[model samples]
Target chain A: MSGYHIAIVGATGAVGSKMMEMLEEATFPIESVTLLASKRSAGKVKNFKGMELVIEETTPDSFEGIDIALFSAGGGISKQFAPEAVKRGAVVIDNTSAYRMDLNVPLVVPEVNEEALRTHQGIIANPNCSTIQMMVALEPIRKKYGLKRIIVSTYQAVSGAGISAIKEMEDQAQHMLNKEGYEANILPCSGDQKHFPIAFNALPQIDVFSDAGYTYEEWKMMNETKKIMADETIKVAATCVRIPVVSGHSESIYFEVEDELATVFGIQQELMIAPGVVLQDDPDTQTYPTPLTAVGKKETFVGRIRKDLDEDKGFHMWVVSDNLLKGAAWNSIQIAESLHKLDLVKI
Target chain B: MSGYHIAIVGATGAVGSKMMEMLEEATFPIESVTLLASKRSAGKVKNFKGMELVIEETTPDSFEGIDIALFSAGGGISKQFAPEAVKRGAVVIDNTSAYRMDLNVPLVVPEVNEEALRTHQGIIANPNCSTIQMMVALEPIRKKYGLKRIIVSTYQAVSGAGISAIKEMEDQAQHMLNKEGYEANILPCSGDQKHFPIAFNALPQIDVFSDAGYTYEEWKMMNETKKIMADETIKVAATCVRIPVVSGHSESIYFEVEDELATVFGIQQELMIAPGVVLQDDPDTQTYPTPLTAVGKKETFVGRIRKDLDEDKGFHMWVVSDNLLKGAAWNSIQIAESLHKLDLVKI
Candidate 1:
């Protein structure tokens, strides 16, 4: 039973559970797995790969003998515990925005930027869920055609917020359908001053709006995309929105490539064979990606590729993937696998 | 009651009923009102301003003495009866996409380009539900700063399909909540070969995709925006998606203005006083518009205004309005009112 010893912080949360499932399904050669949570959830028992594991309360000393720690509790928790884990010589792969923008912490979407993990200084930040899928979809095209600009509008799922938010959306919809007025306390970013019902509506604000007007979630997509791609020259603008979806996050992207002769066919061909990309575009057959269909998948589904009628260098497509899997859990696991493959992880 | 006679085509449909309500609410100057529908719907009685009007089977002679005819049945109905209504001395303001691109037809969003009504040759076409609202928000800015490019992504409602489609969405949600599998008949587009469930899901394809890989609905937005604004030079691109909402259509628009000095505050100031525009964008108070709040509203709600960090000329905004109202019914009625103001209606 010789394998890497892994500690999963926030193991009782929605994404944390998914991370456990992904690790077990992918068979990451774990010698021992530790389930860690906050004080309230510490004594809870959860099942993983047909075995029950008791959740332990996280402390700075929790990472004493750990080889790797996966963090997904929240940005606040990640900020507080990530450095502590790193101080104990454990590599931290954080799924929060806590250290994503830090110059020292490598933001890695393994499909797109696995090479960045080699430069990681004990902590490797996982990009935002929306940015991870988009990066995987665009990386192949960028490698061949040269990326220039991107203008995207996202239809994100409520699950991106957490387990409680998903329940809130379900309860709100049920209440509205039963002719009872609904209560809202945790949507359109719970940390924001306002809470709106996302039962059957679209909220343009994802995270709290900064003084400059862009929500912090929108800012994450714009900035994280640049850092992950390592190309600040490429222009990016995003309008992140929350729709009444439970799992998959879909995006409508209009991007321009540097190649003057890039055709829609060429783009489709690239996506057809790109790693972790499933091209489901066939309008005549009524094929395209929807949130419902992409719910359990770990791949970024791209479709509806069309050349812009006015702008020669522009093209439009739809991208969708499971927000918890490819967006958070599986992505974190992929980064770990990449590190192991590159011999960067110390056990 | 010494005013012109008016006829309502497709009077039994959703947009058509809304037209009747708008007409009655506005107290349009009318000597008499006639309701016309297909042969199957004929003989049905509907109330208008406390008067029962029997729907007559639409025919070439139905508009014999009518001064104004409002059409909203379907494109086939509009294509078949628009010329007949015009030949019978009635001015037709169609809510269908039949003749929107026709050189002789003036595609109008009354609040944006009412003057285009002056050049109408017996028929005026209403733009798509998504485009009309975007136009109302962008026109004021376009007039003040000059628009160069627009990239929009739409979250259109099920009602935009018709009354039946709205019911279908409701039924799907109900069945899903009850843990029963449901069937989809009239979503994405009724004419499209396949149908997908819209319950808690977003459909990327709105109308049928054209040969060029864009949906007819998406094409309508791109082309109709240019025609409604009378500026083909202002480039446009759209990705039209149908969401499960029952009423309002929401859009996320990113546009570049010709004036490099335009600020977000200046744009908000112009929208505050612009006709048919309601500025609901106080981020501090969390006062943006949602589909539930925009339902039954006639004015276009604009908010979430912000400047792009890297592109100085670029700005982002969210627009929402009842698809059946400002997008169709109200817009058609407004066109007729404009025609009456200019003394362009003939009987």
Candidate 2:
């Protein structure tokens, strides 16, 4: 097969399994695929393009003959193995926060900053899920109107925390519906001290409290947005929240533009043509995007676009996308495709 | 009995039942309680103060001899009978939006603008459920720091749609968890042409879309805030979304103050002393308000308060409260209490 050799780290995890599906469904040509996970998940069999591949334990030497490696296990795994993959002559598309803020690694959202991959020093960081969808929805507007500021409040899904979080949400919902008590062991954040039930509830904290009273997830949105947009001067603030959603992530974004001439229609037009974006905003016809409607799709859905009643340059919109698809698996695959298209990947 | 005679309209509804609870729990003296509903529910009997009150069919004659009438029925019912109640010598505290924007009616959140009730022309409007809690949370800050602008995104509960909407959400969740198909009706807005499931999903449309791509619920928030604060120059914008939560409504509010000297601690101090507002903000301790924690509470809970990174005049906070209590029932009862204290109610 005349194609690139691909290896997916954390192949049995939520995002990892989605990555496997993306590799099978998309038209990306792969000469060989290697499934890698922790030792506990090793020997598990998954099929790809009519071949059964066995998941192997991720060792430092796993990337010796790989052209590209995708990492999404966790921050610790990515931090420990991403450098090993890079040193072994493999380009890593990391889906963790390990190398996201590192000045040496490029954080790329292909739809927004595909060219950033060219300067990657063997490691290209995938922007956070929330930031990825926001970039896809707003990059077009930023290009046309000169982005100034953003204030976002996210309605995130339980799956963003991983598969166990999804199961916890499901079990909690069932328990509550049955009028029985259920333990909340893995919601809001598994590593956090406190666990809150996400069934029919809205948790204000995601990932744990960090600097300036913002959660780490909120900081990822604020910090990763600047890194991916490569514009530190643009003002961005985020309040990350976890809702009962199982898959899709929704955001209410209020943004300001440098050009006071920007109108709702102009922004809508930009989004209508933007890559990986779908405009579903006809209020009169009762058309807009919701979490259920956006699930299982690779595109970011934008709706509820309206101009701020007071400020001419300010506008508000609701954006939704499947957190596991466009937010993770598909985004990493798109980055890999970009590398191949730009002839940056050496096989 | 030397106290005021009170009539409860829509006595079988979610807010109406909550109103009954409020009347029973509070020390407000009432000579008699008249339970009024549509003709279909008129035969039902409810207990209040250990006395059985048979619900009477709401008609023009229903308000005869009533000193104060609390209306929580649909807007159509309020528009049809509020004038009749007023003409029958009753002061109407309407929980519907029928006369909320009427120049003759005072849209009151007692904690924020109880004095506005003094000038009411026979009718006082209870603000929207989402707007009522926001007012209780922000009125203090507006007074102390001079609020200039506000942008809010709400994670509202299905009960805000009415009793039937709550049922639909519960049923849909059960169906979804069972992997069975479910029908969506009576949500987003019952009267609207379309319905979407609110089970583990976020519906952006609330109360139908109106002017400028904004829903009527959003418009109520924008318009009512200015009216209640008696300031037309204050800029307010809102995006009201319905989540699966059964009762409490949560808001993520970003606001700008005219006073650049305002800090997060300063605003927290104001909220600490503000009436009908509870401050639960200590990020270090992972203390913040959630929908589950705010359920059944009469006071609005405010937390996650922080200063904006880019603008010195800007700040953000999370506010949550039971939509049926502080948002409707308790607010209406509080208005009645204010009327009595101010000698505005005449029997």
| Candidate with the greatest DockQ versus the true structure | 2
Which ten-residue region of model 2 chain B has the weakest summed lDDT? B23-32
- lDDT per residue (tens digit) for residues B1-347 in model 1: 37879999999999999999999866457888999999999999999989989999999999899999999999999999999989888899999989999999999887888888888889888888898999999999999999999999999988888999988888888888777999998888888779999998999988888868988988898888888888889899889998878889999999999998899999999999999999999888888889989999899999999998878899999999999999999988888888878888754
| Cα lDDT tens digits for candidate 1, A33-54 | 8999999998899888789999
lDDT of model 2, residue B69: 94
**Candidate 2 stretches greater than 4 Å from native:** none
Candidate 2 at residue B87, lDDT? 97
Error of 2 at A192 (Å): 1.0
| Clash pairs, model 1 backbone | none
